[model samples]
Target chain A: MKIEVTSQMTGNVWKVVVAKGEQVEEDQEILILESMKMEIPVVSPDDGTIIELKVEEGDFVSEGDVIAILEED
Target chain B: MTKQVVEEQNELKQKIDKLLEKKEKYREMGGQKYIDAQHEKNKLTARERINLLLDEGSFKEMGILAHHQNLHPTMEGKFTPADGVVAGRGTIDGREVCVAAHDYTVLAGAIGKVAETKVARVREWSLKNRVPMIWLVDSAGVRVQESIGSLFAGNGRQFFDQVQMSGVVPLICALMGPGIAGTAYLPALADFVPMVKKTSYMALGGPHLVRSVVGEDVDEQTLGGSRVHTQESGVADLEVKSDEECLKVIKKYLSYFPSNNEQKPPIKEGVERAEITINERLAEIVPTNPKKIYNMYDVIKELSDDNDILAMKPKWAKNIITAFGRVGGYPVGFIANQPMHLGGALDGDAADKAARFMNICDSFNIPLVFLQDIPGFIVGSKVEKAGIIRHGAKMLHMVSEATVPKITIIIRKAYGAGYFVMNGRQFDPDYIAAWPTAEISVMGAEGASSILYHKQIRKAEDSKAAWSEYADQFRNLIDVEVAASNMLIDDVIDPRETKLQIFDAVASAWNKKVERPWKKNSIRPV
Candidate 1:
């Protein structure tokens, strides 16, 4: 299954934790967002390989923006 | 004895034998072929479900011989055994409960007038006896063939009766199969609704009706499947993989709830003794750094007895978690903010979820435990247009109106209105506590600094440096000790001692009582 991890809040990408094609476990931080003066991590929804990292570090993403795509195990 | 007396006794015996044979035939349930088909679909027969749910040899079947009374020429030879419903009183875990299992093998489990009467009778028994009402819904809605005319207006008394039963008794509805149109409402008004993964669905209109009425083509699963309801719509509570698991989940759910609102939840006395032990994992589970994320379930596990937390609407509103678990063997509803999603912030959906769960807990006399790591409700124009104010108000209303014992734990950030809705000190939490890492403030220090010292920073030679300096000072002042000194909270405790502190408080408030000035009811926020 393919899952799109979307941003729950509008924020700047503090850092990209995983690269494209990297294997990540469920809840593994794929990226971090700086929002509301808090560093919120966007975690993988399931154990999967990250097919795409849509945002880069320092990029501003709005709420509902796709952060990454995962191909689930 | 005379030959005439012997013949008369033989005749009575034959009549009794015939009645038993008729019941045996109805038990076949649309014969072997349909039963096999149901099994192939990974579903259980109505009788099988009832058998699995109730105690051994405890089912007292009712209306087993019931059949439809529709006299239309098209239905002249139709045979609908039990009128497509298997209903009776049975005991589950030694407690009596009324069950109505829709038999999908018969007439596709289309509900007819007779079957409705049978279900209504069971519902009456449930209400009159103050026992829990369980509905194994697998119906294809009303029998449209029999009521193809204008008499549908007089029907729908079931939902009205359900509303009356709500809050008074635990009304549990499990969707084991398709629940189309009117049947979908069974779970809507229910206190607990669990749907079978692939086999069950609930929609206001089935595919056929939907296509013709609105001219949109869609399948039943896509429209109202377990995923759609449990994840997207928040209509169902839990989605189980199979029929057996669904029934087991129901039994487990009932264990946490009293049969009726007049009683307190059942306790596992053995588990109570082990609840107060301080688990070192609790300290490791939560991060002292507010920005660093941690799973709230980890924290919940350390507090719950046996680490068993039956979460409700877990997939939807992922920001908030509404779950039933035991602390000190006493059933409690834990409403915690999930930092993994939305930085543990409360939004419209999160507030709605918490509000509804609060009503359920408060109504059933279950003590509530608030795990506050909230950054407060979501702000900005997008949420305002989504009616966040009114939706957020529901939580405030429920938290204030909830008369049950409330225990608040400010683990990290308890800022803004989130504190109030999450049972802040003003909300009358019986024993409110904060941890050493707790930051109880009106707002985040950074945001408050920017607003409060906007002029000071503007006048400073280096505005950015001045702002940071001011923000650092404000951040230090937002500590738990300030609240402690002001006596705003009960006490600040070590993170490792959370389980013991909560358990002792819950045990003490077991016999809590609250009296309110009587009114019909307060008009709560929608």
Candidate 2:
């Protein structure tokens, strides 16, 4: 199953913690967003391997933007 | 003569024996086997639960002999005792309460036509007598055999009555067993729902139905157990270890509410101020830095009498704290913004939570106390798409319509529309007080300054230093002193005198009859 990880808030992408094809556990941080002077991490919703990274560091992503895709086992 | 008299007495004895046999059947409650099964599950029988809930020997059962009258072949021969429910009037700690406990032993506690009527009748009684109602729901939905025509048509009355009794009398429900399909509405309508752990489960559709429709293989526990409802869904208010514990929790909860909307909450004697004293640490509680988060609950505890607070919907919309507490031994509702969560912003969920709570407090005539530290309602496309405007309007409508005495204490930041909806002077709050730490403004200084001086700051030799200077200048313009000087707030009070000020305000407004303009009713934003 392919799971789309969406940004919950609108913010500038501060850092990308995981790379494409990397194995990630559920609730592991995929990327961090900077908004309202706060760092909010976008975490994986399920245990999966990162198949695609949609946003780069410093890219401004709006809420509901798909930041990455994870292929679940 | 002696022989005739003896024969007559013997005949009377035979009539008494038949009456005892009927009473024995009533006590059986679906026979001994089912009763044993309930015990094995570590659950109290319906009657036993009622006995535990009410004061000793205070229950007066209303419909003990009620039974199903359906003549269908399948139901005709069945002996559905008490119509699978035991409803009655009872006293919990000398306070009168009506209860309807479903008997799981009887036909799996299915709601028959007669049982539905019995439940509705007790609800009406509760409404008329102005007594709180308790529903011990453990039904396996409606009786399938009797789910036809008028029987199905009349089912809506139960839920309708629940809505009618919503703010009038406290409606509490305990989920002791499966509450699926139609039965689930009981808990949903209740002011408070306490579900027993492990055994209690509720769902609109059961596992079998899910499997058939969605091809999901799930067990009943995994689908709608106490853990899921209490922790994830926010449907159940509390989870207890057993049926007895659930009853105890309900008793404690009802003690904080009045019997009906027309009456004031019963006051507990000897409830003194907190022993630790609030005055000393009150000044230091709110940090000087605007970005730092402090616990709003700690402030509430300091202001409340004896640190007593009964929080509602604690898990959902955590940014806004809604609770029932006392000041100077008088009941009042506390609506505060928790800076610790989401910077105390009024999001859609927080707005909905506060609005509903305000309506309840207003209906019951409980005074309102707002401790404002709200930054503002959340902005951006995300919240807007989530219908923040409609949801946020609910708070405005509720605050405007609330007839109860309102006192707003601005402890920290009160920016933008958050100030207006949090019972600002425009809302005609009875009293408005502010602490020295309060910063009342249209928006936070940083955001306002950045927007207003964007060009100048960007062109400055040092952009960060330029932005900070502009922000400080903006912040100085809207401090607590400015607000007080402009007469926007009633007074800038000392942090230590907060509880006394709130108490005096509520006490003074207690008997003042304020006339409201005549209106049928205003429409609330949906």
Evaluate model 1: give its lDDT. Answer: 0.91
- Tens digits of lDDT, candidate 2, B1-526: 6998989998899888877787678867888999999999998899999999999999988877789988787887898888899998989999999999999999999998889888888898999999999999888989978877565665577888889899999999889999999889888998888889789999999999999999999888778987678645778777777988899888878877889988887766775445324476677787776645568888998888777788876655668999888888878999999875566889888898899889888878789999999889998887899999999999999999898899999998899999988999899889999998888999988999999999999999999999999999998798788778889889999898898888889878875456788888798897
* TM-score of model number 2: 0.85
Model 1 clash number: 0
**Which pairs in model 2 have colliding backbones?**
none
| Model 2 CA lDDT for position B112 | 89
Q: What's the TM-score of every candidate structure?
A: 0.95, 0.85
Predicted complex 1: CAPRI docking category? medium
> Chain A structural similarity (TM-score) per candidate?
0.96, 0.98
Cα displacement (angstroms), candidate 2, residue B283, comes to 3.5
Which numbered prediction scores highest in DockQ against the true structure? 1
Worst 10 residues of 1 chain B by lDDT: B269-278
DockQ, per-model, please? 0.61, 0.11
